[model samples]
Target: MKKRPVKAAMIGLGWWGRKMVAVAKGAADDLEVVSAVEPYGDTAAAFCKENDIRFFSDYSAALADLEVEAVILATPHDLHEEQIDLAVKAGKHIFCEKPLALTREGAVRAVKACESHGLVLGMGHERRFEPPVAQMLAAAADGSLGRILQIEANFSHDKFLSLDPSNWRLNASHAPAAGMTATGIHLTDLAVKLLGPARDVRVVCENLASSFPQGDTLSAHVRFKDGGTAYVSATLVTPFVSRFAVFGTKGWIDIRDKAHVESPDGWVVTKTSTGMPIEVSHVPPAEPVRDNLVAFARAVRGETEYPIKGSEMVENIALLEAIIASAQNGQVVTVA
Candidate 1:
């Protein structure tokens, strides 16, 4: 017997939400975009009409549609928690964009809501699905990286620099710690995945070029309870700079991105060992965003567990909160 694709509603029609719809269009065998919810009714209605999907201006109206098995949230950061609560009450599986919640408590509540309901809680961390990153995580998990000592990463770009001054992304309240919410949070999620939960953090945020209230450049130092350390940074006013490196006693692995996750150019990876020749390889461009969506759909179908664990989701938010606190206070803050 053939299984049907998961019928889902995308609850935001922003750029990224539209991208998800396009990706899901390509993966029709596994996931189906049945509808969408957006406050911008006319634009969203036209988009949905062109795509042959239903559109609703009210979120609760979409949730009441029994055919929507899941909801994908690509909305603003501040609305994630409240929206997740609504989806939970409606008995829908959830796939939320990154920095799931601005605060640890909110993240904990979101995770618990889904867990208690036995609903799949998918997160938008497509980086882990990237070929080179998956390879790096495999090496770390299998002890090929030996005793991990440190990881250094920087994910930066100038994409948001030209946004209208009033855009939520440029506002301090929605996107704290400069590019942390925009880009650095992904770095922290990967860091915590490899190094375990963060123990403490120190940070510096500065507005060097752009007029963004939360600043344009961010640098963070994190110490993991298990002894690994990480230097993470992001800049909102730079050419695309995506790089991740892990150093261990036995060997080291470095990955550099030729394009951002949204564009999917490709990746160059270099592996070095104590007495072996350096190995370098190029990973072809991949649709990691689609890959993540399919993975979430599979989890919703009970075919497999989602890769990003619930604990990691909460821990990433905790690390994010600590980073923001440290940046604001100019002092180290413990990750709660």
Candidate 2:
């Protein structure tokens, strides 16, 4: 093939952002974090020094770099729309983390901006690159799973308990519907990937244990545009649990594992059809986040199309907003 290493900017040097930078460091052949932006200068400077990348307190400074052709945004939820718009205007390919935008309009606007600029926009739905998620997608595509019927997932972890008031994730406006935006959105993305866009959403969520303003638990029911339905839940203050089950007319495939990129010994999958559920261990043949980074590089190089297109991104964001609205209003919200 071709060697097309993208000079990229890593924005938002928080927990997840730092992890992404590490992935970039690991995949040094495919992509490079040539620049980084984080409001807290000390930590960002230290990190950039460690990684040997440029550091900036403001994102616009990174955009000025002619060599940085792409950017991976791990910024706060509310900041995505404006930052994406700016990046697209800067003529840079973009990869943004999950819950692309908190509002439907904002998400649509971001997608459209990328389209108008003719830029590759990749959503960091990293789990989509995961082995389990990839297997589920294969089932949906290859007829291994018959006509899709439903998807059930419960992805939760105990990380939010560590969040202090100063963190953006603690604010309801930043992470509405409790774990919905922070964690459950992965299942939602899997729903879209396996069953297509969601048509309706009903959610119930709460912060059960914390004295802080955090959303701890959430359960959402989604109706897909293509007749399949899904139930996905997430909790904040609990042992890590990541299970995604996709049911078809013939059989159901289930993957059980800990949260992303964590080495929990390994992952397991169970497929049930005739009688006993067949279990198998899965050690990802390739590192998922690294693969995603390489894929983004390919997209930037015009070697292939971006798998998650702008339209699907817009639809997923619509569903995300619907889920949040449903939880807050205590009713089913039809996805627009």
Candidate 3:
């Protein structure tokens, strides 16, 4: 059976949103970007002309169009919940990027709105679609990890030290908990996806040497609902590192990627059995952002269901908020 492509209206023409569109072009066969909402009138007009997708200054104009059946949001972190509510109300299926909302209550409200309209709500947690990550998650879930004991992960980079103060990445409210929002938040979602919902979080965010208030380092310790523990760290001024590992009584699996974004190849995974190290192997590279978009298109077309449910989304946001609260209050915060 052939799958029909989804007709989507993309909201936002920023770098990330534009990259999403660029990756989908000639790559995702099941996605058709029919419209775009960009506040910058002239730039949006030029982009729409080149891409051949309709451009509108107001998102509501795109929503009003009958040709747009879905909405793809890459807007600011704060507008997610409100925009999702409006999109669902307009009867459009939605695909929003990670850190879905700035807070848990907002996430819950957005999820409820989607449920009320019976719209498919998709998220762009691109790492979930990475082959190595999928393999590690499968191993953890399929008993290969044997009562998973601990998970350790880190995503560190030095981009923040050179960032301008006005950049959204350096905004205080947008990313108050240092690299928690920019980098470490994905690890939190991955932990919850593989382990379970977070019960409590202990975080310490510090600005080691930078003068910026956004901070430079974030270290979080999370306890899962199942009593499993995880340590996740993210830093702004550091060598590029992407390391994730999960250990259990039986054995452990480790993943190492040389770069933060797309690398020349996929991640290298090392495993152990009987307390002896196994040879590391390369996992086939995948375009995760493209895969994530294709997955959303598939779900909207009814070819498959979206993997991240509304409930899971709420939990992820709650965990993020708890981490921020812990770091600010200087105490462990329980995730509600």
Best by lDDT: 1
lDDT of 2: 0.82
RMSD of 3: 1.9
The order by descending TM-score is: 1, 2, 3
Global CA lDDT computed for model 1:
0.92
lDDT of 3 by residue, 1-336 (tens): 765678888899976788877777744478888889998636878988899988899989999999888899988787788898888889999999878898999999888988888788888888788888887788888887788889999988887777668777788787778888878878888888877899998988898978768678889999998889999998888878888898888888888885655442578889886567686888766688888888878877777888777888888999998988888866999998
TM-score of 1: 0.98
Off by over 4 Å in 3: 1-3, 262-264
Model 2: how far is 23 from its true place, Å? 0.8
Tens-place lDDT per residue, model 2, 104-146, is 8998888888887889888877777777678779877988778
Count of clashes, each model: 0, 0, 0
lDDT, candidates in the order shown: 0.92, 0.82, 0.84
Better of 1 and 2 by TM-score: 1
Residue 169 lDDT in candidate 1: 85
Q: In model 2, what lDDT does residue 152 have?
A: 88
* Alpha-carbon RMSD, candidate 1: 1.0
> Which residue segments of model 1 deviate by more than 4 Å?
none
